[model samples]
Target: MAAEQAPSSNDVRTWERIDFHAHLLPDFYQRALTETGEAGPDGMSAAPGWNVQDALSMMDRTGIRFAVLSLSSPGVHFGDDAAARRLARRINEFGAALVTEQPDRFAMLATLPLPDVDGAVAELEYALDVLHLDGVAIETNARGLYPGDDAMRPVFEALEARSALLFLHPTSPPNHGSVSFGRPRPILEFPLETTRAVIDLVLAGTLRRSPRVRVLVPHGGGALAVLADRVATLAPAQMDLGDVDVIAELGALYYDVAGMPVPRQLPALLQLASKDRLLYGSDWPFTPIPIIEAMAAAIGSTDLLTDADREHIGWRNAVTLLPRLAALAH
Candidate 1:
């Protein structure tokens, strides 16, 4: 691996204006590709298409002062527990090293071999205690098991104990649904799956029990934002205890502006969520990084929020969620 360069004087354009979600492939994954000389699992984008330099350049151009990197979808689901554990360690270490090399520009969200509850718990400890990562990133469903499932209680317990930040990225569940039968992943399914996992966590008592636990839901919080009212009306028994309006409960959680660039969606989200709870995300490598600048500008242009609201959404909110960054501004 190459040494990371220090951020230039110009690089410090705006402290704390960071992107909370993006991804990278570790060296082990590259080795696996090199040794096997084969394309990875189908319907997955885990290939070595992007790297750290690309990420940094994007940040520089977009006026983003920092970024928190995490592993993308299908995380550790492709291998057995041992393989998954080893891969997660390598990825987490690489992420930590990247942050260390460029302390001014990066932070990390640790990856875990989830559903293997023991391994996930152990990985969380190692990543936080050893690597000093800011948070953990887990997919919507780990091998067909939702975060609400009892099997993942250990991971949740460990995270809740530490008030850890969890970045929830959506992945298609096993045999998700028919999407033209041949279409790849079906764009609709990603948001739908995210909605499913979000509801599962709320209804299964995960959110209520872990009040301190902060979760960053991707793709504009998926269908959960759109269907909050509908889910609220399902039944008192259908949801986790407390207010019937799941949408109101969601306001208690957090969201990133990863995919909600459309006019209607952003306003609806603002109406439902407090300004301080919204954060910025680029979904880089998938969406063009330059698009992030456009999104940021669009967000700035919205009358639904005040200048303070835009500033919070653009950066201050992330700083609040990631308390570790409190000292950097000086």
Candidate 2:
């Protein structure tokens, strides 16, 4: 397929980018937000403006070839299982429609009705088998139930059986009240919760049981990059993997640079995940287009990454995970 029209910026339009951590808000989800008058999921600010045209325009401008869309935080569940199941299907169908409309420009990570284990599995089958999505997007914690919860094992088993591409995103920790000192949840809370979730997931041994599951943690794996030793120290006592190297286990999973890949984040991310495991993400709509473009430039110029490594993170690494996007390589 021909590339989309280029933006005014003449930096270099030679390659296409794959965004592994973008989001979509269905009409129903938006309506719910409107009804509640929410500023967004963290309840701190309004949900960012989102629409396919805006997302695609930004992608074209920024050299992003394809984006894997997922529902943002405060996922499908709101204490009502029926609402969760219905919304999951509705939102997924909305995403599938986009892929159908523009196969090259859009693909989706199906949202699940999680913490409702059976509902999640059922949604997974429908989304994958029928809708043919790229994979599923799971929150770090679904309805306050982190990935490690035993109750969600069957769902993980189903995903593992398929060797699924599971994208893990952070949700606000349940102890929001205690942490808030007039600061929004995204500040220190988001990364801390993400760190806790990843560690807990590892401790639960979900990865061991689902060895084939290809996992991608967003925001450069949150604080997990520098927390390896802390995790390693705790792992031996927290879970019974007699002689396993905790760092190795953490390294095996993939991570995306959605937010700015600043100085502190770059080293740890590169050290933890090899070139092939680091993918690009804009966190579009939530992250302003200008910021995403700046992130791309910053990451592109950083000496910490060789040209080849940056190339893989920007576009090539994703081909291995979702072959459909590989067409761009030609």
Candidate 3:
């Protein structure tokens, strides 16, 4: 039997196709033909509407050069410490191997066992030192503990020490009383939860303490724009340690225009963040890739960013923080 023939590379320019946010689940998690009674209307766990090969084919058609893979929500964050730890290892190994097999077409954001400091640290070491993942993708909350909870300090510290990129994706809190009025999460819950998480992190001083850890928030930073002023007004002038504006410190974070129309939101984001801190990410699998491309195109057409700035947000910032991707970006 002859060896399998590899697909030929296309002529699309590298810069034309950098999708920062894409998700893929392991085959073990596929619920398409799942016998478990957990299948939702859409299909699988979170997004049953799409799959791995479907995403890659879409990328090819759209001229998307690469996609940074992350596990969809509730990612090892809800399980007990032991289960979470094992799941993190499984996801990272699966993701790293995918990148290894298709070096030029894929990269990864490792998942970690949150709210479990020791497990988080262990997973980070394994992911960075051994598997060589690009970064870690953490949901806004772990069970009921937000990323900024005191228990999560060590996780942030480790990520900061490693200069890791922590992509913050939103997930609904475990308890919901009034919000879930026969609606799917993405319509409103996702953004609402992100706002809550952002506020918690800012008030908790996570941003100030972890200066080296660069975070990228999704869904146009979900309620961040509208709530910035309110947070500043209510924040105390001084913490026991120092005086800092909670809102101002938010500028230190990076945000992606995933699933948002760039023309409508990029200008607002520019007012709140440095051009270099803004990135292009497509919440693929959940949303269509074409919409993401349109957002990027709209942003590119705005003339709001210079060539260097575009390059930085579109590719370089990710590469700088994700040392594993340094050569790939070049």
- Give the best candidate by lDDT: 2
lDDT of each residue in 32-104, candidate 3, tens digit only: 2243332442122444466568878878776666788887775664446886787789889988988888887
* True-vs-predicted CA distance for residue 121, candidate 3, Å: 2.4
**Each candidate's root-mean-square deviation in Å?**
5.9, 3.8, 6.2
TM-score of 1: 0.87
State TM-scores per candidate: 0.87, 0.93, 0.84
Model 1 lDDT tens row, 1-330: 999977543232333367887777656676655454423432544454677888888888777778888887657646478877888888898889899998878899999987788888999999988888999999888888789888888888888998999989887667854552544452667777788899888878788777778988887777666788777777466544666456666888888888755577776676667878888887776667556666766666667767677678767787789876666543
Segments in model 1 whose C-alpha atoms lie over 4 Å from true places? 1-16, 30-48, 237-245
Alpha-carbon runs more than 4 Å astray in model 3: 1-15, 31-38, 41-46, 49-51, 77-79, 237-241, 303-312, 323-330
Candidate 2, residues 1-330: lDDT per residue as tens digits? 999976533242444678888999766788876664454668567778778888888888888888889998878887779888998999999999999998988889999998899999999999998999989998888768888889888888888888899998887888787876757777677778888888887777777778998998888888888888887887688668777777887889998988876777988877787878999998888788778877887777678877777678878889898887878774
Cα deviation of 166, candidate 2, in Å:
0.3
Among the numbered candidates, top TM-score falls to 2
Model 2 residue 179 CA deviation in Å: 0.6
Candidate 3 shows a clash count of: 1
